[model samples]
Target chain A: MVANHELQRAEEWSGLRGFTNLLYKENRAWWGTRRWWINALLWTGMLGGLAAMVVFMLPTIAQATDDPAVAKAGGPIPFGLEMGRTVFFELGAMALAIGVIILCQDLIVDEKQTGLTEWLLAKPVTRRAYVLAKLVASALAVMILLVALPSLACYLLLSARVGSFFPFLPFLGGVGIMIVHTLFYLTLTLMLGTLFNSRPPILGIALGVLLGGNLLAGFLKPLLSVTPLLLGKVASLTAGSQPLPPELLLYPVIASVLWSVIFIVVAVVRFEKTEF
Target chain B: MNQTHDHVIRTDGLSKSFGDVQVLKSVNLAVPAHSIFGFLGPNGAGKTTLMKILLGLVRPTGGSGTIFGRDVVRESVAIRERIGYLPQQPRFVEYMTARENLTFAANFFFSGPQPKIRERCEEMLELVGLRDKADRPIKNFSGGEKQRLGIALAQVNYPDLLILDEPASALDPLGRQEVLEVMERLRKHTTVFYSTHILDDVQRVSDRVAILNRGRLLTSGPIEQILNGRDGVVYTLIVKEAPQGFSERLAGLSWVTHVSAPETAGASVWQIGVSDEAAAETALLRFVLEDQNVTVTEFSRKKYELEEIFMELVKGESDGRQS
Candidate 1:
């Protein structure tokens, strides 16, 4: 019923046509409803609550007990920093890698199965725009809910235990490192979503890369340099202000970023040639 | 735009194949502007495949097509910008409200003030008679309501061409009537090209129709021309009592090609196939009344139903293929 003259022409053409609209729809799915607050509570409770227990409850337990072995194990506040660094860098990274795989598993496959992809492509939307919008919006949501906010909370919890602020820049760098690592898995899952028709293969291959990749890296030493294998160790060391050679830190970060880009390119290319 | 044919949609020798199976043969069709063009075909008749090719949802294996003089393959995006599509089974985001779905579909074309967009969505809801259920989630809608929503979304862009695949195929009688009524009202604004197997619906609403059977275009033209019978004109006469020379009286004329008298319970009926309509209209009835013993109960030109023609065409094509 919209009058013909009242309509405004959309300026977007080939590659970027309908990109903003799709991005808005994807963003609304994350932030416009209860999804935002629910994810914030879930990730914060898991990551920040564990950090709080590490810095506060451990020393209290060591003081309350008279056993020497328990006392030695509890150690001091530096021990809490090490534990907090492990919580944020290692555990947080692994949890977020798994979280992104579970979160974005349906981003493409569900739409394909439900006939939404055919419906969407019938419009003026280009295949590139569709895949790019999904990649950008989902990455932002996953990083914000699973990485940024929870990492900030962990930072404050560790700083509070030390009776002063922790080094802000180093912690921020570690958060960036964790984001790159998580994006590697996020893009992998999204690419797998495009390649396969169902959720199992996407979940299987992405999760395998996260868990099995680490296990295999223990034997295949060269994989530590070329893959995202050493990213967690480098993030933990960097956040704890421990120094190492620059290549040890730089190589994994570069490798993870490169792999994420490759995954996105594959997703877009495969989706372009897709029929319906 | 200047065109070889003033058609909103034109396809030349369009064909599609999946593996070893050829679903669409060389189909040449032209749909005129601002008309309700009915695409009639039975199941597995390649109706949906051809629609998908025009929409760029499926790639054709051979030939080409154009919409508004733009190439269907090279300029598909630009062509799509001026058209709206509704699949046979319209699917929407189940959790989103009807209003949200309309707005989503509209945003693919128009991007301006949010209030203007909202106003357009509301107008489409009102047009489809879904104003009362605008805020309801699509998951709660019935089959008819979902179809109405599909129509609303397909019209949100005010497209110049609207392609609907089996719009009323799954609906009840009332729902089908409502869909046809909506199509009737939109004829002045846009060209509607819809595919269906329902002969009655096509006969009632379509000005132009194309019948497809077994991936081949059997016949296509204005509905009236198609109903006039392709072989020639035929006249019918019912006689109560007929002399033995009654058949010879009609067949003796040069214009009359064949005369067939079949038995009826109360009277005798004759089907007169004529080479010229004027000759039959003037002399055929008079020839029957000339006999004093014969009582002419009924005399008129035979009218063909769409169902009859569709059956004949399908049967002929099927028989032709078998032999």
Candidate 2:
């Protein structure tokens, strides 16, 4: 019985050994990687801003709710503050977009310029693992900062403004939307990096896409007057004044999927054919 | 056979053309299980192209290759799962310490299991002789240390096959020794396919070598057999007193093609191309004692260095085949 057990243990040890070996073989190598501290420092900054914003706003939100006046209030501004609602969506959205691009830039373009791709290709790591780890890490960082931090900010700010309030459902919904949008954008950024394989070109491509997409939507708005295919149907959602038509509301989702799919295909294809 | 290593990579008639120039011309080579095979070549010899093809990084213009017997062009995942590669120039995230850099790398491979990784990371750091420098940032590391870390990372999981292209080219002598020593140690468990113009390195470590020149393999075999040929005769004869007519007598002798003067005064050395080296050895011994030398001290066979033979054969073959 002891002999059998020893044999089993030895077998299991070999199996573990094999797994660790595979982890090295199939895993993305860190050789030729861009500065890890840069990514770490960048992540800390984004999350730090969110933490500070939440900490600063939470007490004020609690005090406002205790007064009962703001809690029971209803007005065009949501409270009596001037030019306040713009601060919520406008600043938040812009911050989210900027943060997402910054994080993705390091993950994709910076790594390429540092010659990590050649090193990575020499290893046994699959293209899927390499790109996905990058996308996931950066996207997760974007989500934590863009979605989670902002969610906390909104909750504290909203609770303080309205008093005696929990905005859990709305916060979750916003975060969910932000995550989906970020993934879509992340996918686009990855494709651009793979296509260009250089810094200035990758940055130019990513910047062109984000800014160009919005500009394209604006340009397509006039065309929408003549045709249903135009951005007229989707661009109108930017107002946030009226409830969305189900199809029109799905526009971002659809566009996100479309772009993501295109990027996924391009990355997979480019990955297979490239020589180290 | 173990699944990960079974048929990991394969290729056939693999060729590549960078526009009008043909870089890899129908090149063929194979890596067996657990052997240090040196990809010997000069610059622009397409060894790099062959390696890239194995890695599935570049699309070949023609032909194919295999890593672990699997189709290199099609089943790269198979090849990838059992291999670790260190390119000629290895770059790391400069700002992060070796530890942090390794941790971030571990995440992509491990995905979870934090405790195990910490232990393994320490162990790997030790293996590459960088345990004490774990906390030191990679940017501050000298070229040797960074390269040591590079080798550590390459072997972290103890891959079955480690593909290192010119692993010691950028290193100083000490740095080169460190890398080569680590590779030597790793050879016990892993198969290393190292490419380099450094023939001494290949001579010191490689069991076998494949010489590539002008995008084609000039010759490939065990270093010993290939270097001196199977039966090529080499001799080192030391005499107590030298003869004035030693060169004249040795020169026109049958089966003796080349001769060189000795660094020592009373030493006579000659390399003869004889069909049977044993027969030539007997004949040379008789000729030396009977002909001229007053007394012989060290009369031993010459051991050819791989570097000299390699340069001669490959360069000669390429030059011979060029026009």
Report lDDT per candidate.
0.87, 0.63
Report clash pairs, candidate 1.
none
TM value for model 1? 0.93
lDDT of 1 by residue, B283-322 (tens): 7777767778889888888889999999999999999989
The DockQ of each candidate is 0.63, 0.23
The segments of candidate 1 whose C-alpha lies over 4 angstroms from its true place after superposition are A60-75, B1-5, B240-258, B263-268, B274-294
lDDT per residue, candidate 1, A70-182, as tens digits? 44545656666677778768888888888899999999999999888888888998989999999999999988898888998999898888789999988888888888888
Instruction: Give me the displacement of residue B76 in model 1, in angstroms.
Output: 1.2
- Tens-digit lDDT track for model 2 on B195-281? 999988888888878888878776776777777753466666666656787766776677776666655654544444445576677
In candidate 2, stretches whose alpha carbon ends up further than 4 angstroms from where it belongs are A1-83, A121-124, A164-180, A214-218, A222-241, B1-12, B30-35, B93-123, B229-231, B234-271, B287-305, B317-322
Candidate 2, residues A1-276, lDDT tens digits: the string is 011112111111311222332233222332225434444445445544444454345445644565455454443224332113234343445455555665565565566667776776555456655665565555555566455654565456555555656445544554455555566667767777667666666667766765665667586764223222322223223322335675555655566667677887787677545555
The numbered model that scores best in TM-score is 1
TM-score of chain B of each: 0.91, 0.79
**TM-score of each model, in listed order:** 0.93, 0.73
